[model samples]
Target: MTEIVIETRSGTLAGIGEAGLTRFLGIPYASAARFEAPGPVAAWQGTRAADRFGRQCPQQFGGKVRRDVLESETYGEDCLYLNVFRPEGGSVGPKPVMVWIHGGAFLAGGANAYDASRLAREGDIIVVTINYRIGVLGFVNFADALGLPAIPSNIGLRDQIAALEWVRDTIADFGGDPGKVTICGQSAGSMSVSLLMLSPRARGLFHGAVMQSGAVSLIHDRERSIRDARRYAEALKLDQSRLQRLKTMDIADLMRAQAIVGKQLKNAIPAAPWYDGDVLPASFDEAVATPTAPVPLLAGATRDEVRLFDLMPGDILPTKWDDLKGLLRDQFGPEQTARILATYPRSRKGRIALGSDLTFVMPTRHFAERHARGNPTWFYRFDYAHPLVGAAHGLDLTMFWPFSGLKMALVRGGPDKGRRAELGQRMRSHVAHFVRHGDPGDIWPRYEAESRKVRIYDLADSFAANPEAERYAAWAGRDVEPGRGK
Candidate 1:
């Protein structure tokens, strides 16, 4: 395990650990950002220590406890890096490669959270997990703010592009076929992949994509994104002249500002991708309708995706009940509100399911349907729930990466272990096959206009066309307004 050395343009680095594979951790892709502007990392002479994880960019604490995770790791302005994993006894010939971008809304998450060893080891492919900017430091827009000459909005995406460039140039030495790369991610990461699908800068960077639980439908416009920035600025009390003072402020201070701004707006400002007329020219539906990228795609969502984040449904039930019919009419209109209530009664589980379908599940299906019209598309619905948790949003990540018995351990106390393993194999196989041959395996036919087939992941695997029709029909056929929070 210790004898393997991977040589890249920057130099050779040693990696440890195994999942029946050779795993390399924390290899630099871009130069350390300084003063917040994107820059190039000058080439080095000696073997750089690409053995450890890079510093994950700064972000606010939402729910997950990651303080200890960050304690021993180094982080700084120069934090652009990625990790690679390959099967130990993998065929000597080139292997397919998959690059992963993580999701924490768009405010936080890192490559370190996921260990690609299991995927690389079992699937016999090259697995790369990448780190990118998050929160105000990464996506906050201030292009016209004269005080900050160093900061740039969307540095996070630029970092992702740089990482792909690194893979194109350096991955072959690590036993990967750069030409067969498949870029995949979930939530904001999926949103990132969607943007890259339309980006001229990202063209030819990868041959395929797999998006889980996110799509192009939710990207904020420039005005919306800038409005978020203004909220952040107001939270920090930074005037135009004092805006540059942000770089020197404590990272924690910025994080607090982010949380404050997020709270002050009552969680309204979603500063994700923007239609900058450059990276993303229009909304995802508009772009796809115009025939955006021809790249083969695999896209889907969990059966109850919103359970992980917005678990409580009674919150909405109470907020609108005072003006129940009017608010219901606001959402579904007077004519259709009654129909919606009839379809999804206010039971303990009904509202939660409705919320999930409205926010993540149905939108994802809509995205696939729109894209399938123009490109080869595959759709899936993950419904295998753990005993305590339903088929939640992040469960697929646990199976695909299968890391330190962490998430799997927490969720495996029931009779679902065998089912989990089966689903893991089937899903991983589809992902690996997609990376290699631009297809998601033989589980189901490619989504077509007439057939509309989708591979469903439950206690057992099955095939159907738009299997969530009941929920989808309730949402689509009826005139429900988009989720206000989304």
Candidate 2:
């Protein structure tokens, strides 16, 4: 391994070259206070060491995060770092770039969790993974509830946008093409990509996108957002007059308050992006009706998206039939809710299907369908069932990076380990192609409303025309009205 230095708009960074890749880790892209929007990083006087990862955003210890990531990462308030991986001795010309946003249901993840080495080396592209504020510090909106005008809504999204801006102004120095950047994510990260497509501030920052296992169904509506904020304030024993004290409180104190609110909501996400009209559309209905950024999109979900959550504690998703029914009733009319519920049986399999479709699958399909109307679009479903969980959520992440033995076993186990590895390679190839050419190659056909073409990834990759048509029909016109999970 040897040390290499590259100059950027901020300063010179000393990265390392190791095993056929050049790694620049923990490069700060932006800075911000507790609730303010992200701002530019200060210019450094000398070459800053980019050999190790920066501290992650302050968050809770466990809950939905990978065990390895939870053990390895450290957290702090000033965590606005990004990592860049470039293939060693690749084309001298500028290469396509992919910016990855890690997902933890908008609360528990950091950029260090994902290593983009294989993606950069095999795809011959520069891959950038970013860290954004999560949990109460970044996501919980306090602008309106506490009468704090300076506190911005969706600071996490703002951090992501800042990272992209840094990439646009500085990536070319690392042999990356600014115009060919593709933003990609999984779960909450995927939802972030969807919202960014609809965000006016994110226009022109990315040329394409790939969403895995999530969309806009999980955002908080205005009423729910303010309600949750008030709950947090009460948990912290703060009011509008004491709101400014939030900046000076201990991180542990804030986390304890967040936990209090989480238990109160019982299964609903305590912190998530809300449609504040500044960073997002005015309301959930307006967001659905608004046209997204006219960029090529590739998005999909797993066959059994909710199964993983079923094994875990808490109803982070509506895994029970009754829970799913109540959420549907909250969103749709009595007649429409009954009609949708009648489509599924009362058995275990039926409940799993209902939870998966309503929470992740259908929302992904909705985004893809809307995007296909004008811009280029490709949709897919991961059908390679896990031995125990049957292709659960976060399974796609294993297909992209080289995970630890325990992590890989979650999705790549059973008697077909070799076959699953091959499947991962194919999926990565398609994603790289999409990032490069604004399409996932010619083999995977573009998604159109008339055809609804979808690529199914399994032991043997195949194409299907609108898989699960009945379920799609049942959810045809219904939309998730983000609110308090009553």
Winner by lDDT: 2
lDDT score, candidate 2, position 474: 77
Q: Give the per-residue lDDT digits (tens) of candidate 1, residues 94-196.
A: 9988999999877767888887776776678898999887766677765643345446557678788888888898888887888888999998898788778
* Residue lDDT tens for model 2, 1-486: 999899988899999999889999999999888888899888999899999999888777334333233223566887999999999776678999999999998878788878889888888889999999998888887878788877888899999999999999999989899999999999999999999999999999999999998888788887888889889988898877776689888777788787778877755888989888988998878888989999999999998899988987766667777778887887786887887878888898888888898888888899889888898899999988877788889877777677766645645564225877788788888889888888889578889989888999888988999788877887875666435424
Model number with the top TM-score = 2
lDDT of 1: 0.70
TM-score against native, each model? 0.87, 0.95
**Considering only N, C-alpha and C atoms within 3 Å, which residue pairs clash in candidate 1?**
32-78
> Which residue runs does candidate 1 get wrong by more than 4 Å?
17-20, 32-37, 63-74, 144-151, 267-271, 282-290, 311-343, 405-408, 412-416, 470-486
lDDT of 2: 0.85
lDDT of 2 at 141: 74
Q: Which regions of candidate 2 deviate over 4 angstroms?
A: 61-73, 414-417, 482-486
